[model samples]
Target: MANDFPFFKKQSNNWVYTLLLLPLWLVLYLNLQIIADFLIDDLLQLQNGNHLTEALRFFIFETPKVLLLLILIIFLVGIIRSYFTPEKTRKILGNKSLFTGNILASLLGIVTPFCSCSAIPLFLGFVEAGIPLGVTFSFLIAAPMINEVALVLLIGLFGWKVAIIYIGTGLLIAIFAGWILGKLKLERYVADWVYKVQIGQSEEEEKLKFSERIGGGYAAVKEIVGKIWIYILIGIAVGAGAHGYVPEDYLGTLLGRGNWYGVPLAILIGIPMYSNAAGIIPIVSVLIEKGVSLGTALAFMMSVIALSLPEVIILKKVLKWPLIAFFIGIVTSGILVVGFLFNVIM
Candidate 1:
C-alpha cells in the first residue's frame, strides 16, 4: 500500500522524503506513553498501585514503545549492515593477525546483524576467505551476543550503566573465547562440507545510492518487525506478569546476588528459551525491579540470546559436536564468571 503512494515510495530513495517522515516518527514516539495511559488508566480503570493493573499497563506501554524503537533502530542498522556483508567481513579479517582480527571482528559483530541462523554460511565464508578460526569465532560470538537490538533495548529500559556492562562483558567473552579457540587449534573440527562447498562470486557488487539505502532501511523495518513482533509481545507479557504479580522475595531469593546458585540457575533456564534482545530486555527490567541481581538477570538474558538451543541446532551443519560443546562450555564458563564477579562486586 505504501508502495502505491508517490510520497511513500519516493521516501525510499529521497532524502527530502526521509526528512519529511521525521515529524510523523517523532509524533508517534512521543505520544505512545500518553496513549498507554489513556488505555490503562482511563479506559481500563487500572489504578497505579495495583499489581495486576500495573503489570498489564507496563506490558501495554512497553510493547509499542519497544517495537517502535526496534523498527527505527533496525532500519538504520540495516543500512549500516548493508555495507558490511559476510563476504566483506571475511575480506577484512583475512589479512589481519589473530589478535587484531578478533578485536575487529568483535566490533564488527555489533553492526553486521548476523543472527545465529547464519552461522554456517558466515563460518564458511570466513574459512573460504582464509580467515582464522579464532577470528571467525570472535565474529560469531559477538554478532549475536552484542547486537544493537539488545544494546538499545537495554539502554532504553535499564539506562546506560547496565547496557554498558552488558556490552563490555559480552565483548570480553567474544574476544577471549575466540582467542582461546585459536590457541587450541580446532580447525579440524569444522564440517567436511564447509571445506568442499564453494560459494560462487558474482561481479563486483555495486554500491547502493543514499536513497536506496533509505529504502533498505524501510525494508528492514518491515522484515524484522514482521518477524519479531510476536516475540516482543510474548516478552512484554512475561515481563508484565513478573512486574505485577511475582513476589519480590521469591525473585530475590531465587535470582538475587546472595544466592550462589542464582547465576547458574538463570543461565540454565535461559538456554532452552529462544528470544532476541528486543524481546528479553523488558523482562530483565521487571526482574531487576523485583530484586533480581543485575548480573544474574543479565546472565540469563545473554544465555537466551547468545546460546539458545535453536542456535546450537543450526550450527550443527558447520561445527561438530565436540567443537560445539567446547564453544558452549567456554562461553558458559565465562558467563558464570561474569555473573559471580559482578554479583560480588556490584
Candidate 2:
C-alpha cells in the first residue's frame, strides 16, 4: 500500500488549499518591511532612531523575508532536482574527458543540491558508478558554494552584479580546481575498501505526474529549510547586531584592503567554519556595508561554504590524508588568487 501511494496522494485534493495560501504568502512577502515597521514602531511603540530598535526591526524583517525566499527557491530547486537522480548524474559524468567533466560537473552542481553531510554517501555512489574523482570534487565544491539558495539570496539581498560575480568566480574555481586534481592522477590515494565495495544496479527512474513534481518541491522545502533555518537566523541576527552596534569602518580597518593581512586572514578564519550560503550571505552583506572589501568577504564566504572542516572530515573516510591535504591545498590556492584578484580590481 505504501509503495502504491503517489507522491502527493493526499495532496491531490489539496490544490485549492495550496492556491489559496500562495496569495497570502505573496502578500506577506511583499509587505515584509511594512509588517516589520508596524511591529517595531507601532505595535511595540519603539523609536526608530535607537540601535536596539533598529536591530529588532532588522531581525524581524530579515527572518521572514529570507524564510519566504528560501521556501520558494528550495521548492523550485527540489522539483528540478527530481529529474536528476544520483545514478543518472554519475552516468552523465562517466566516460567524460577530464577537463570537460569538471566543467559539466560544476554546472550540474548548481541544480542538484547536496551538502557536506551528503558527501560520504555521494562518494560511495560515485565509487560504485565508476565516476572520476576530479569530477566528483567539482560537483561537491560547486554545490555548496554556488547553490541556487545562495544565488537567490545574493540577488535578492545584494543585487545582480554581486550575484553574477559570485557565480562566475565560483564556477571557474570549481572547474579548474577539479581539473588540476584530476591531472595529478590521485586515484591511488583513495581507500582500497572504497573501490572494492560493490553496489547494486540502479533501477530506472519512473516518469511522474505534474502533481508529483509539485510534491517534490514541497518535500524540498521541508527538508532544506528545516535544516538550515537556524543558521539563517543566526547569520541574520549577527548581521543585525553588527549593523546596530558596530561602528562604521571598524571592519574596514581590520578586513578592508588597507590591511595587508586581511584577505588571507579572512580565508584562514573561514576554512574551519561551517555554514551554507543562506547562512553566510547575511553576514557578508553586513561586511560589505561596513566597508569590508568584496574580494575578502567573498573569499571568506567561499571558504566557509565550499571548504568547510566538516566536508574535509567526511571525505577523510574515503580519501587518504595526503589526498585530503592536497585537495585543501589546491582549493585554498585557487580561492586565495580569486580573493586577491577581486580586491585589486573591485
Candidate 3:
C-alpha cells in the first residue's frame, strides 16, 4: 500500500529510511532545545540573585540536563552507525575517483560519533575494507570534527546559520586535507607497527537487528556520557564563570579586530584542550559575548575539536610523525582561513 504512493515509489529505500527517522530526530532535537533553554533561563535568574549560594545551585541544576542531552544524542548516533557495515561503506566509496571519494567520505564522517581513540580502529577497518588512504583520512577528520552531538549543540546554542557554516567549513577542511595528503603519497608514513598487526575477522555477518541496534545505542549513550562527564563539567564551569565575571571591556580589548594576534593565540590556546563539541560550544558562546571575534572564537573551537593533543596522541598509534604533522598543518591552515573569513563576513 505504501509503495503505491508515487513519491514513495520514486524515492529509494535509503530515502525512505531517512524519512522514517525524521520524527525521532525531530523529537530528540526539540527535547534538547527545551533542556538548554531551561538551563539558560535558570542560570540567568541565578545571576540576577545576589546570594552566594546561587552559583552552586545553578551548577547542580544545569549539570543533569547537559548530561542527559549528551547521552541521548550520542546513543542515537551510535545506534545508527552500528548498522553501517564497512563493506557497504567501501562499496559506496570504491571505484569513485579520488575527488568524489574524498567528498563522500567527509560527508559520511558527519554522521559518525567516533572519538579520537575509536578513530584508529575504524581507520584500520576502512583500510582493510580497501578504501583509499585519502578518503579514509577524510572520514577520520570528519567523524571527530563534525559529529551529531556537536551539530545539535551548535544549533541549540547559536541557531541554524552558524551551525550550517560550521558544518560546511568542517567538511571542506576534511575533504581538501584528505585529498592533498593523499596526493603526497604519505601512506608510507603510517607506523611500521600498525602494518605488523594482523587484520581481525570480519564482523559484518553479526549485524544487529533493529531492536538490538536500539539497545546498543542506549548503551553507547551511557558509556560516552560516563567517560566525558568530567570534561563537560569543567568546560561549562569555566564558561559559567566567564559568563558571570569576565570583563567585557578587557575581552574586547584583547580579542578585538585591532589585535591581529588574537586569532593565532586562540588557535594555540585551543590545541592543548581536550573538550568535546557540546562542552566547548558554550565556552565559545561566552567568549563571543565577552567580545571575542566570531572568527577567532570559531577558529579556537575548530582547533580544539579538530586537533586536540589527545587526538594527535591517538593518531600516533596509526600514523607516523610526518603524516601526523602534515595532517595538523593542513587542518590548522584551514581553521585559520575560516577564522579570517568569518571575521571579515560576520
Candidate 4:
C-alpha cells in the first residue's frame, strides 16, 4: 500500500494509503517527548537528577527524534531531487560563465542528488559536461557542506536566524571558494585520465510521473537514512554524554570567543574526523549549550562535513596534490573568516 510500490501507486488507492500513514507518523512524531518520558519516568522509574539517568533519557529522546526528522526531510528532499539529475544539473551549468555558473551551481548543489561520498563522480560528470571548473567546485563544496540534513538539524535545534546565517555563509563559502579556485585556472592539475574519458550526456529525465517521484523519495529515505542512522545514534550518544558530564569551563575556555585560536584549532581537529551533518549537529548543539561560541562550533561542523580527510583523499583520485591543497586551503580560509566574523557579530 506504500507509495513506493509502482503497482499500488498506479492505483487511486495509493494516495489514500499514503494519507493514512501520514496521521500515524504525525502521532508518533508529535508525542515523541511524551513517549520518551513514559519510558524513563514512568516505566523505568530512573532517578530524575542522576547524570546517568539524564544521559540515558537524552539519548533515548534524541535518537528517535533526529532519525524521524531525518527520514521525513530526506524523503521530501529526494522527491524534490528527482527533478534534478546529474545530467540535468550539468546541462544547467553548461555554457554558464564564471560568476553566474558558481551561483547557479552552488544553488543546484542543494537540490542535486549527490553527497561527499560521490564527489569524484559528480566532479567528473560536471567536467565531462563542460561546466567551468570553479563552478564544479562550487557544487562540490555546497552539496555536502550546506546539505539538507545539516540545514534541517540546524533549523530544528538553533532556530531560523542561525539557520539563515548557516545557509548564507555556507553559500558564500561555496561561491567564493569555487570562484577562487576557478581564477587559479587549475584545470591542468586534474588527473590526465579525467580529460581522456569524455562522456556524452544522456537524456534520462524527459518526464516523471507523481508516483515515480514518490518512489524516488522512498529510495532516498532508504539510501541516505540507511547510511546515516547509525551515525545519528552515535552522535547523539556522544552528545548525551557531553550534555550530562562535560565541564562547562573546559568547553568555554577552549572554544569561547575569548580564545583567538578556537576557530582554527576547531577546524584542525575537525578535518581529520568524518561525520555528516546528521551526526555532527547534535554535538554542535551540545557545544553551544556547554558555552562554546557558535562560530567555533560551526567551524568544527563545517570542517568535518565539508573538508574531512576522507573526502580529500577521494579528491586525490582526480586532482593532483596542488589542486587538492588549494581546494583545502581556500575553503579553510573561508570557513575561518566565517567563524571569526560570526563570533564577533553573535
TM-score of each: 0.85, 0.85, 0.73, 0.86
Model 1: per-residue lDDT, tens digit, 306-346?
A: 78888889888888898998898888988998999889888
State model 1's lDDT: 0.82
Runs of candidate 4 exceeding 4 Å displacement: 1-13, 34-61, 201-203, 238-246, 249-251
Residue 206 displacement in candidate 3 (angstroms): 2.9
Q: Higher-lDDT candidate among 1 and 3?
A: 1
* Best candidate, lDDT: 4
lDDT of each: 0.82, 0.83, 0.74, 0.84
Off by over 4 Å in 1: 1-8, 11-13, 27-61, 237-246, 249-251, 282-286
How well does candidate 3 match the true structure, expressed as C-alpha RMSD? 8.2
lDDT (tens digit, per residue) of candidate 2 on 128-214: 676788988888888878887787777766668888988999999999999998889999999889988877767878887666677
- For model 4, residues 67-91, the per-residue Cα lDDT tens digits are 7777788878988998988778888
Worst-scoring 10-residue span by lDDT in model 3: 1-10
Q: TM-score of the candidate numbered 3?
A: 0.73
Residue range 1-346, candidate 3, lDDT tens digits: 2244344343334345545766765675557546544555564454535434445544544555565556667767877787665456666887767789999988878765455656778877777666788988888888778987676666544567888999999999999999998889888998877656778776546645565565556556656666667766875565455545645698777876668878888888999997777678877877876889888988999999888898888888889899989998988888889888888898
* Clashes by residue pair, model 3: none
